[model samples]
Target chain A: MKKIMNAPDAFVAESLEGLVRAHEGLVTFGAGRTFIRRRDLAPGKVAVISGGGAGHEPLHSGFVGRGMLDAACTGHVFTSPTPDQIVAAMDETDTGAGCLLVVKNYDGDVMNFEMAAEMAASRHAIDTVIVEDDAATGPSLRSRGRRGIAGTVVVEKILGAAAEQGSNLAALKTLGDDLNRRIRSMGVALRGTTVPENARETFSLGPDEMEIGVGIHGEPGLERTRFAGANEIIRLLGERILAEFPSDVAEGGTARPLLIVNGFGGTPPIELYLAQGIAHRFFENHGVVPARTLTGTFVTSLDMAGLSITLALLDEVQFKLWCAPVATPCLSW
Target chain B: MKKIMNAPDAFVAESLEGLVRAHEGLVTFGAGRTFIRRRDLAPGKVAVISGGGAGHEPLHSGFVGRGMLDAACTGHVFTSPTPDQIVAAMDETDTGAGCLLVVKNYDGDVMNFEMAAEMAASRHAIDTVIVEDDAATGPSLRSRGRRGIAGTVVVEKILGAAAEQGSNLAALKTLGDDLNRRIRSMGVALRGTTVPENARETFSLGPDEMEIGVGIHGEPGLERTRFAGANEIIRLLGERILAEFPSDVAEGGTARPLLIVNGFGGTPPIELYLAQGIAHRFFENHGVVPARTLTGTFVTSLDMAGLSITLALLDEVQFKLWCAPVATPCLSW
Candidate 1:
């Protein structure tokens, strides 16, 4: 790839500096350019924070705002943020309300956030919520569970909005748990992306093949299928997602769900919208009453050619909270 | 150029359905599949709306919410939305509040939205704000300016927030006009992205050459330079953007402008951050204190391999409103 940089090793630090400079109003850095919130925290408000490798643009930092995360810990590209970085962000944004750590269900991310949460709990009543949104990542009832993908943003936004509205840490944790159960996501990658530092491709794909239900870090998806239009692709993915929801939920007696169609980096908005269209039709065919839908590159792989669809069943309270105001780099209220 | 689609023609409708299915809480569509806001509009709010080609996700539709846009029109990939579609959205979202049409600097988008505004204004006090945010496009002093690119999003968000805060159509139009002066964006493309329907490349570039200051529709950038690292790329692009700002603006105490490092589709987050780092260092060296910075794929070129940088100089009011609450599919408040 034709990239401009002084040195490959210097990319992360320089990039973080650029992020801080660009979002100075909402983001800042501590020692070693570790990410932190720019605002002064009110005393006694629990600081909910999360972070991961730097490659995901809006993942940790993009989510730092009023109705979302208080701060994010950033690591190197496609690598987990260090425990020290997470601890720093927690210290910077922590209020007596105690901090909640929202982590993706990735092995590295889980281990790192888990260690940080344990450290925070040792210091205070810090709580944590690990989001396992990607159904493609893990077995339903086994080791580690699903890998967290784009759904982390929804979890953080929903929970962060609740926290901003002054929900107690315990209450927020309960809300997080409940919301987690109601959400599920799956992705497909048509092509691979490269990590600049490595200067090598992350994964390989046949010219005519797509790996459905792929992972964000370039892990293999559930199955390989011949390339198809977004409609067919989404139908297959939505059927799998709908299968996970309670049949009663699909029947829509009393519940409506929020849908997210997220692009895995190189996928364009045009393609995402097409995917959204197909998914919407699938829901209508299934007799589900949709509440709200989001389509875009919310969470992403580093220019991977793919997308993920995440569904969150929202009650009135969740809906209202989701609508609350927020200010961060990537998203607002 | 590997894609997972059955045919190009089915991309848009299928994608829209999938998006609604994925995000039923935030968006809804008419029987004909026109995307709209989930909430009903008040009778006296000026219905500000915009849309163009399908690649620019979250621009028209994502900006629809409280304190932002009322509704958006969608088009096929890189194509302007039909006038009928724009009219339909206006009728649904516009109450007594006169509608404001915010069109990018593109010839197609401008002509289409203008025609629709004229049609709507005959019945209502519809006004329009033409955004020439891409300084690289419509000549600053010429009748025809540069095509609006990613910077259009900033203009739309700021004006939309003002409208949500009860600004009338006239006031919102003025804000939009003022934003056009305060905003400037320039983009670069390393590679051209192919539309799924075409299944063929839209533009071509040498494997080692990068197009700087390129237009969104795959037009060549200001320069086709040898690809370098992030720092070098930032220097090349930053000089143009900084120079575009009048010496008085840069010299006069502006509130350090907001910086947007937008990807032209296929560029990876790592590369964007690397570019962002370079941009930040350039600003730091120049003593330009950026008030806010956003780095992501805002306006995209199908899957083009490049990124753009946008600077929006905000006055106090615009700054506060920029931080206001919003809810949309792609962008949150």
Candidate 2:
């Protein structure tokens, strides 16, 4: 595996070190490197926190700032953060209003965040909003249900805005849960990622084949099919996501959902934007125009060459939350 | 070649289509498809325009908005924009104060911009600033000296800010030229890029090899040597780039030049940020601290897995220009 690093074991820590240094004024190390803390912590506001594996970068950490996450507990690549780390994040960031844990629907993540909540049960009034927006996996595929993927950005954006606007922990949790149910995402992988610690490729695909419905952690999808053109690939992913959305949002024939074409690390912006164009046309044909579109490497799996499509149906409240001012390292408007 | 594009021939057009569609309120297609025009073009303000091959995302195109370029001409991938395209861009954006053309120093780009400037000689007061900051090449390598690369972003940013502040074309040209002289950049490629039209890999390297000082277009650099760890590799590139700087700027013990660690497509954010940390340490060890650092996939060779480092010495005026607000899709502050 041709990966860039000094010591493979120090990959996650070094990357975190660089991130904090680069975004000095925005974020800093929190409670002993257990999490990244936003610089401006408005007391009495709800503390929004989230974390998962380290590879899907600029996710939880990059989202830490004045209008996003208050703190982001980081785990190793594709691994869950220890309950101790989550506790540290909570201990350091929770305001009197309380805390909202934005947990992705993964076995390890759910369990760890739950454990952390239990540990902090006495001091903080906390609520959890689990994101399970991946359309590929569900109760039929795995008993655990869908694994959260790129739609987490939408969840974070909306929830963070709500938190910043003085929403209580319970209200933020309700908002996050509603947003999660409205969003659906699916991805295709042209290549797999090499996990830096062991230097092992999470999965491999033939040169002329692609993985359909792949997760962000380089997990194999439902099908390993022959390679196809960009339009066909995006169509497959888009169709899956649309099918999973509520009929009112997907079949409304006129409502324009927020569409996101998120790159999986290796895919460049040019291709992501091209895919966005194809996706817009595909949705327009289905009578749903993706009016608010975002294209970039927001969520990634190391060096995996692929992308995920996310669609979120936002009401006036959700749209207002998204439009609120935000200043973070990876995202701001 | 594994690329997310439909009908390689339409790669550039499709990407531009997505860009304009995504940034509807900020920009639109000018007169023809030849250029992207800023939607809020201030009448009588100096029109800052730039164009180049289309592979670099957010480069000339993504930088068009308030406090940035008034227009950006688009060319085919890795190919210069035709003189006609530049002329169209100038015709659409030139205000009474005139237009400033920001051209990258390439045989084709310089020639085309010069021809367009001559063509508009009577109608608009056009001044051209050609950027040539690649540290790996000079008189010994090619008659044209160094080729322009990632540093073009800085040039556009500073000039764009000055233009927005109502600087005339002549003043902007002088500022741009002086900024160009103070920046030096160098890159290394772990893998090469395949030009999409013909599916041609611009250059090739063995599994255990790397190319040093590689240009952004997949052009072979100063050497192709065995692969090494990230620290040693950054040290070599850092020393070479530092040698090209003026003695006063580089040799001064306390001065800090703005450092840019730019990725060439395939490398993900984790690795890029890690490299940035290393590059910072390397520069500090050489007695020159890189206080202002910008790291991202700014300038790219399509899907090439590598990165470049650029250091620009900014005086107080230039620093303030860098601090000016820019509301573009790719970059904003």
Chain A TM-score, candidate 1?
0.93
Sorted into a CAPRI-style docking class, model 1 comes out as acceptable
List, residue by residue over B1-333, the lDDT tens digit for candidate 1.
565454777666665555555555666775367655546575677888888877666566656666677777878878898888888888788788778888887777888888887777667778888878676654744577766888888887888788877899889888888888788888878788777666677778886887877888777666687877666777777777777765666666677477778887777665677687677668768777676667776787777878888877788898888877766666664
Could you give candidate 1's per-residue lDDT for residues A166-259 as a string of tens digits? 8998998898887776778889899877776788887888877889988887777889988776667878788788776555544555366777
lDDT of 2 by residue, B126-222 (tens): 8988898998987467887788999999999999999888888889989998887788999999988888888888998898999999987777799
Off by over 4 Å in 2: A248-256, B251-256
lDDT of each: 0.75, 0.86
User: How big is the positional error of residue A249 in model 2, measured in Å on the Cα after superposition?
Assistant: 4.4
What TM-score results for chain B in every one of the models? Answer: 0.94, 0.97
Give i-RMS (Å) per prediction: 2.8, 1.1
Which candidate has the top score in DockQ? Answer: 2
Model 1: share of real contacts kept: 0.74
